[model samples]
Target chain A: MKQPHIQLKLFAALTPLSPENSDRVPIEPGISIKELLDHLDIPIVKAHLIFINGVKRSLETRLNGGERVGIFPPVAGG
Target chain B: MKNTLSHRLNTLALKASLTDGTPCRTISAAEVIHLADDTGITGRMVEIAALREQILPDRYLRNMKTLSEADQIRLLESAVCIVGLGGLGGLVTETLARMGIGRFYLVDGDMFEAHNLNRQLLSSIDRIGMPKVEAAVMRVKTINPGLEVNATGAFLTSENADTLVGSCNIVVDCLDNIQSRFILEAAAKRAGIPMVSAAVAGISGHVTTIFPEDKGLENIYGPEDQLNMAKGAETRLGCLAPGVNLVASLECMEVVNLLLNPQKALRNRLLVIDLEDHTFETLQLA
Candidate 1:
């Protein structure tokens, strides 16, 4: 049996995640957003918004294997 | 210079106190002598007793006025130039305006959009489509009519950067784009004025005091190319009032503290705040 791989994409300001700054975390098959965050040690409450693939998702949303997740901090502008 | 404390106190008596009960007083040299008498520091017939020492005491005395009329005037006369007039700029402008800053040069090419109401103080349904700088002047005047505000409804670009910063003592970079930030920072450095810059990425925000002589935006944030390469949106991505105010409050604190003590100010440190976890920390940019 082959193992599934997961990719977590990080972005800030206008800068997207580069190979140097990106983190590749693998997970066992399918994991929920809450579980994925817990695995990354990220506080779910601290996240302003979360994006799984390209669409916004809530904390309870599950993540499919090889899904790219982007988590945004709160919006602190003007 | 004559002490104007007494005169200002008299004027303040007529002016209603702020919600905080602190009378907004803008003093001048001529009123210092009167202040000295009212505060029991001067006599009607006594000679001016070391006026300089009387005004600027090394230590603040309890229950006694620490600043003389002249000192008060000088402090209030300080001018701050804020560029962008967006979320961070709007908050910074409001804070400084309420702090009794004597003058401000408000610059912004953008107008109030319906989307801005989420975080911008000057944004409203009626104000939507109005220039940001114009609305800012009206709002600030309502708070402190004595404030000398110059609303320039023009975008801040590298071309006008020199002229914009030449006369202001301090420049605040509240712009979202890196190109503008770099231009404004360069202009401020050339003008020999200090700049307090703040930026936010999602819930993470950074505040730093930039002294042109020492550390600068370039060396700290890296080159323009590196900054531009990063992906961020200028439009608010669900901008919340709490988050904007949080960063604004921090920026305001640094600005006010710097105005009070320019010589001993926050320099070369990036203060980052994460409201999600209520975490506030400082990172040194060396």
Candidate 2:
């Protein structure tokens, strides 16, 4: 039997279960960000931007091991 | 009575020291009492003396007689122009006000919203709807009544930046946006004033003192391209209060040291602080 791939970890400053957070909702490997968000019940519309390893990445990008993914809402204040 | 005493002290001690060759240092109790007018600055002078003594050692205090009480008064009258009244600028204004910088040209158009309540010192429940500049002015006045604060509630565009930057001893860039920061830098350079800039993102922040002819900040942050990227990609990770306070305190120290001793200023270097990992480091850009 093959082991389950646990490659994606989501984190953010004011988000649910961020990388620096332990309550994170992890996802299996070989999944796109859109798929993972769908599986985790996270609203992509609420999270306006995404980044991997501190560089902005597209939603269609696939996850890699040990990558730090961050999600954030649009900033309205100064 | 307080103002009377302060005025009397100002007249006697300042007149004697200005006319004669007194040490021009800290005023003595006799001078304070003799100068005491009906206004009665009885408590304020004592408080100022205590603050000065605490911050300045006896050795440095012994040689102060050179400047008259009037001149000491003038030092307090110096003006500073600060941009961005946010994390760094808020605390910088507070520190300078406590130090008796009598005047400030505060420029910022943002309102005090819920998000800023965490790190910005002036953000309060009562002040949530007020403009940042207005809130900061109130806080500074509460700290020191003598400070003359003027607000420019406008974004620092190239239109009025030169006029604003030209009027102060130095410019402090605590701005978050890139284009505005670059415009402020350009204005400072064009006006030939030193700019002490600081940036805080999440648990990381950096402070750098930039002189007009120096290429220090452009080196680490890169030219306009990287700065724009950093601005655009910047997630509102939201800095904690402690992080902003630490970086703001450092910026204030840099400004004060530069004002007093220009020869030993921290020029062309970025002092980075990472509170999450407990790391304090410096990167030289020259």
Candidate 3:
């Protein structure tokens, strides 16, 4: 049996916090976006916009593995 | 805007054959300037008169087909207020001016600094201490002497936001900070105009359009206590030229789209670009 996993991508200020600096991050099945952030020690406030496989996702959305998650921070500069 | 002047300009309009063998009425930029000098009218008026007769200006020849002659006239009749004159604001003004935006209200109290040379299109070593707004206004004039612009070398504050964005067809929020952005958005809301907003941070940038009735910057940056007065991710990650210029170009496109076709405007949508991955994605903001 294969281990449950999800690809994680981080952007902006959160880029430094990405695990191994790679998108192939393992995750627990049925994990909510909020929980994934918590597991990675990424504060919820810093995750301004959360996306799952190119589509916008709510913090409460659940991931069942094999999903690509991208999180972005608030970017405001000229 | 006077009909008598327009009528006189209409008579100056002459039919010409294009390289494609299509015959159409056209007016040269020189002819428009000459008419302005002779009649003591604005070159904008003369250009408008030429467009009224379907006489396209030689200067706007490149915008043909992509923008119908009617759209060119619409652009000439439009005005936009661009707040801030740093990386994003500088390039946004440059693009819009070239696109034939007739009037502009430029606001920025900041002057060009050494760091601006990397991304600010109008910045130069010689203009290190010159106000960004002044530099932008001069550049716009050189691009199209007929364009009218009101440059304010003052930062947009609560007391002056209303006046800074007064009576414009649209507003472009190229501001650098979260607080100023919210202030500009509120002013645009009170004035009942749409605003094209964009920001940059390191290798990433995002563009969004906020109309008077939209939720505005608060949605992107979150609640007042949570993020209002805070600096954005840019301070931590830093800003660069590529993201800045790309975002400004996107904002210009939004401005033009709003002007030519309101239905196609980027209302309730956030388009994000990641330079590292070279990906552009539109996320729902509604």
Candidate 4:
């Protein structure tokens, strides 16, 4: 049996956290938002907002494959 | 009273040789000043001048389609305080001035560095060392001389925020740091004024309207200690012009909506936009 993967879309300050500056990345399904952030080298502390399938979610929420995840950094710039 | 105001306006219009119901044209600032001095009533002069000169004198003529003349007048009489004259603040002030806001109190303690020219609307090479608030005041004066702008070249803090934001009807948060933003939010809350906050970095931005009773910046950034340990997006990814402009525009719209149609404002909702992928989503805040 093979594990499923979910797609991630990193936005704003979170883009730099991704390797190669790719806008989209694949991650293992069932991984919590916190775990996915860790895998992508994005400090969970740096992310201020997270959305899954266009809905706001907590870091502890688990991701299912085929769902789109968006991560945003706190854009404090004027 | 309406008839008297209209009669005074008509007399002024006749004196200026401005025909009624014509295309918008400019009225010399000198003429308006003289009328203000003669009548001893500046408001009536402004009203008459705005109507006779059409769009040019009114400056907000286009706003008539969306806002009633009374609403437009309300805008002209409203006072808004902009905290931070960097990227977002510069654009917000520019748009608000053009919209005929009556008064402004601009707060910023920083001087324009070479790097600021990349996004700050009031920043130019010649103004590299000028105070941001000074530059903003100069720009506002150029945009709408009728507007009264007070430039405070001091950083907003817990001590001074109350004095700076207390008198204004609305507060715009264009700050670049969480600490300053929190300070501003607290002051705004204490003053019982609504705050329109916008922030951007890279190709994404976020906007929200927070009323006095709302949790505001706290809901988005969490507690101060947690935010203090985290770096802002600008520090990590830098900022771009498009992101700054888009967010500022939205923030300005929110301010206008808050003034003219409070029921339709973004209030309690966080609008997040990712220009990179063209994704815009509004999340309901608790």
Give the alpha carbon lDDT tens digit for every residue of A1-78 in model 2: 343333333322334433343234455667887887776667665444455654556679787445656554332112
Per-residue C-alpha lDDT of model 4 across residues B170-267, encoded as one tens digit per residue? 99999888788888988999899999998887768899999999988877888776666434777766788898999999999998999989988888
Each candidate's B-chain TM-score, in sequence, is: 0.75, 0.76, 0.94, 0.87
- Taking the tens digit of each residue's C-alpha lDDT, what string does model 3 give over A1-78? 776888887888887888984556777788899998998899898898888876777899999988988888888888
| Best of the candidates, TM-score | 3
Q: RMSD in Å for candidate 4, one decimal?
A: 4.1
Q: Is candidate 3 or candidate 4 better by lDDT?
A: 3
Q: Tell me each candidate's i-RMS in Å.
A: 9.1, 7.7, 1.4, 1.8
| Candidate 3 residue runs with Cα over 4 Å from true position | A1-4, A20-24, A53-56, B1-21
| Top of the candidates by lDDT | 3
Model 4, residue B41: displacement in angstroms?
A: 5.5
| Residue B119 local lDDT, model 1 | 83
The local distance difference test score of each candidate is 0.63, 0.63, 0.85, 0.78
- Writing each residue's lDDT as its tens digit, candidate 3 over B21-126 gives 7787777888888888888877777787788777888888777778887898899899999999889888889999888888889999999889889889999999
Candidate 2 at B229: error in angstroms? 2.5
Candidate 2 lDDT over residue span B147-243, tens digit each: 5677899889889999888888888888886567778889999989899887766755667788999984564445756443435213556677887
The candidate maximizing DockQ is 3
Model 1 per-residue lDDT at B241:
72
Per-residue error (Å), model 1, residue B241:
1.9
User: Compared with the true structure, what per-residue lDDT tens digits does model 1 show for residues B112-163?
Assistant: 8887887888788999999999988987777655457777889988788888
